[model samples]
Every structure is written in structure tokens, then in C-alpha cells.
Target: MELTDNLKRVKKPDWLRVKLPTGKEYVKVRGIVSEHKLHTICESGNCPNMGECWGAGTATFMILGNICTRSCGFCAVATGKPKPADWDEPKRIAYSVKLMGVKHCVITSVDRDDLKDGGSIIWAETIKEIRAISPETKFECLIPDFAGKWENLQRIIDVKPDIVSHNIETVRRLTAQVRIQAKYDRSLEVLKRLDEADVKTKCGLMVGLGETEEEIYETINDLSNVKCDVLTIGQYLQPTPKHIPVAKFVHPDDFKKYREYALGKGFRFVESGPLVRSSYHAEKHIF
Candidate 1:
């Protein structure tokens, strides 16, 4: 598992390249997001599929403001003292979903450790407002671990989004290095609690961060033990030099193998590829 300095700067493969955002639909989606003053992980995380997803008229909306309290090494979201929670964000997000005509929307947020409730109140309100405004629209929430507070986690479960996702982000060995303040087992507990609540729980992992195939399988087994329903595996791309470097570029064939392995492990749905992300093709996982 030793990585040379040369591997850190290895050129990105052609399969990783993506088109720039364009098209009228993309523009319309962008306009709606801008008009509502909303944030999206697609833009904040520099997702390669933003063009494809936005052009298709679907976008993942990020609430609770752009600033994050935790500074995860793998994330591109700004980490610092976040502003006070905007109580009206729920209505605005609901309105934005209505304006975009999104049939299935994904909602995620920055880790709000500063708040006593970890912003779960706003999380519940947002889901309620969305259901009120767009009764037919399905929702998938990529929530924070709430610092393992069961009460905060219960708020989300009480609101009951269609599918609830909380990414493990990396293998167990790399969890501390990548996530800093977050604990790997706490993440599992969060998903486990979601599953226990009869919620359709999902978790995501990023490979190519110096973890071995064995470690990946162990993580998958851990998730399966908790009865996690959906899983996503994507290559880890370094957002900047300051972030953790990509130890390897997993081949597409390897991604295929991982997908099949996860399916066999009893994950109802598995999305695996170099470009796959937590919210990529998220709508299809609702079932």
C-alpha cells in the first residue's frame, strides 16, 4: 500500500473527463438555483456529472448554508464557523424544487456541529415543506452524522424522506485521515439507526485513497451487517493539492467488479464507477 510521489501526480484518465455544463435545460436549472439562492453539492463539490445531471433537469440541493463546521480532508466544501441557520430555508428550498419541476430531488448539507441539534430541526422542516409544496416529488437526503446524537437523527427519521444517505466517505483505515473529526463507527451507527427506523438507508464510499481491496470488502461487509440498502463507490479525486491525494485511479473494469460484488452482498442498488458519486443517478435508488 505504499504510494510513490509520482503516483500522486498521475494524469487523470480519459474516462474521467466530462463535458462542461451547457444546454437550455442546464441553464434553466442553474437559473432556478441562482434565483433561489440555494447551494448544490454538484457545484460545491466540483462534481464531474454536474453537466449531465443539470442538463437533464435534475440537481441536488444543499441546505443549511455553504460553510461547514467540520474540515474533512476529502471534501471541497468550505470549513469554518458557519452562520446562523436560516429558519426560512425550508420554504425557499420547497419553492425552488417546485420551480425546477424536479420529480426526484436530493438534499444534502454541510456538517453543522456548531448547532446543538446539529441542524436536524431545519432538516425536518425542509422535508415537510417539500412534501407540502411538491407532494408527488420523491426525496433523498444525504445527511450528516449529527455527531452520533440519536435525538437529532430521529428528527430526520420522523420527517421520513424516501431514501436517506450518509456517506462513510472512505475505508475504515482512512476514515480518520479523510474525515478528521468524524468517526468511522459512528457513521455505521447512523446508518444502522436509519435502517432500524425502517428507513431505506444508503451509504457511499470513495476508493483510490490508499485502501486495499480487502479493506473495501471489509467496509462493504460492515455496511451489509447493518442492513444498508444502497451503496455507491466512486474513485477519489483530490479536490486540491491541500486535500488528500488520490493513491490510484481505479479502472472501470475494477469498478464493475465492485458493483457486482456489492450486489451479491445484498445491496439493493449499487452505483460504482470512476465518476459515480453519492447523488449521481440518485433518483433511480428511490425504489
Candidate 2:
């Protein structure tokens, strides 16, 4: 599957349309995010479920800043030389988590390939501070691959989030075109290593990236081989015109099939739909 395929974009179906976020809870969440100078993937990645998630009083926080180093074609997060790592981010995130009083919090970050630790130190610190402030809270870290460095990955492993997630993004054939700087097998390795260490490992898949159903099944099997416990499969909406074009708008029935297939492959939990993302209904996965 080519990245742009001559920029021939597919029409977005009605299933992809979403309402804007409103309500008191949504405003409160937004205010807290702004007050602390925090960033969220919900905003940076142009997630369709932001209104639903934030209006319900939860959000997937992005750490290590909004600026990203890797310029993945599918991502909406800005790519450039990121500002210097902020060591104090953990405290603010911890405070925010406590303020929200959420029992299950999902945390993710933009790729910080420019950093020596690839932002793993802050990842660990954020988790630690959250635990310190909100001991009862269950945590999930939707993380970068840390440039495939074992030691940096180990920092997140050491923190022992309730569930550790890294997205496979797209299948093998489309990986290079879609992910650019990411290697297909290396992502599997990251999940495998996390599962080996007894972490509840999870990964997300985006369909509609010109991948065949056979390829999707194959990717599910590969994740199963690594003993990944949770899986999410969703349609890939082109974040912007400049990003990769949507090759297809997968049907909801197909997403159901994908869920059943993943369940049969032994995933403890699966969320498959047009709107699913890595952090979609993340709290349920830990249960």
C-alpha cells in the first residue's frame, strides 16, 4: 500500500462523523489540561472520540511535550526538533490525574527520538508520581518504541503500568509507507518483551490503510504469538490532507469480524470499530 497513492483520497463515510465536545465536564477537563500546560493526544492526534472521552471526564494525556521527532505519515502530532524534556511534567500530570479522580488513566507520548533516553525517564517518572499521588488508580502507558532501545524500554517496564500499549499502526506491507521511521518487526519485539516481563501488553491496529483482511489477520496472529493480551482495531481516518490518504473505509461488520478473530486468537479484551484507537475504552482493558 503506497502512502499517498497519488493523493487519491477515499470519501469519509457517515460513520466517521463526530460531534464537538460540550458540557460542564468537558469544560472542566479542558481547563485542567490548559491550567497545567498539559498536552493530550486527544487534541494533538485529532482523535474523533475526544468529545466523548473528555465529556465523560477522562482523557489520554500526552507526555514529553506535543512536539515529536518522528514524522510518521499517519500521525497528526507535529514533527520537528522537540523542545527540551521537561522533568517537572510528572508532578503536573500527577496532580491532574488526582484532580480528575479517575481510577484508570491512560498516558501516551509523542516520539522523542532526539532525547538520550527517548523520553523513557519522564515516562517512568510520570507513572511513579501518579502512583504516589493516586495509589488506587490503575495506569496504562501507550508508549513510543524508544528507538528500539532495550534499556529505555525497560524503564517503562520497570514502572509496571497496569497495561502497557504500543500501536502496531499498520500491517507489514504498509509499515514502511505509513510508519516511515518505525520497523514492523521491532514493534512486535517491543510487545513481546513487555509480555515476557509479565506486563499486560496491548497494541492498536488501524485498518483502511490499504491493508488486506489477510494482512490484518496475519498481524493479529503475530501479536498473539507475542502473548499480547489486549487489541484494538479501528478505521484509519486521514488526520489531514497532507497525511496519508485513507485507502478504504472499512465497514463496521468487518470490525466485528476482526474482534471475533482477535478474541479467538486469545486477546483478553478487544475493541474494534470505526472510532477505536489505542486508548479507546482503555480502562476496560485493565479489568
Best by TM-score, which number?
2
Candidate 2 deviant stretches above 4 angstroms: none
TM-score list, all predictions: 0.97, 0.98
Q: lDDT score, residue 269, model 2?
A: 96
Each candidate's number of clashing pairs is 0, 0
Question: For model 2, how does the per-residue alpha-carbon lDDT over 1-287 read when each residue is reduced to its tens digit?
Answer: 35686588677788888998999999999999999899999999999999999998999999999999888999999998888999999999999999999988899999988888999999999999999989999988999899899999999888889999999999999998889999999999999999889999999999998889999999999999999999999998888889988879999999999999999999999999999998999989985
Instruction: Note the Cα lDDT for every prediction shown.
Output: 0.92, 0.92
Cα-lDDT of candidate 1: 0.92
Off by over 4 Å in 1: 1-7
In angstroms, give how far residue 26 of model 2 lies from its true place. Answer: 0.5
Candidate 1 C-alpha lDDT tens digits along 1-287 = 42323334868898998888999999999998888899999999989899999999999989999999998888899999999999999999999999888899999999999999999999999999999989999989999999988999999999889999999988898888789899999999999999989999999999998999999999999999999999999999988887777888999999999999999999999999999999989999988
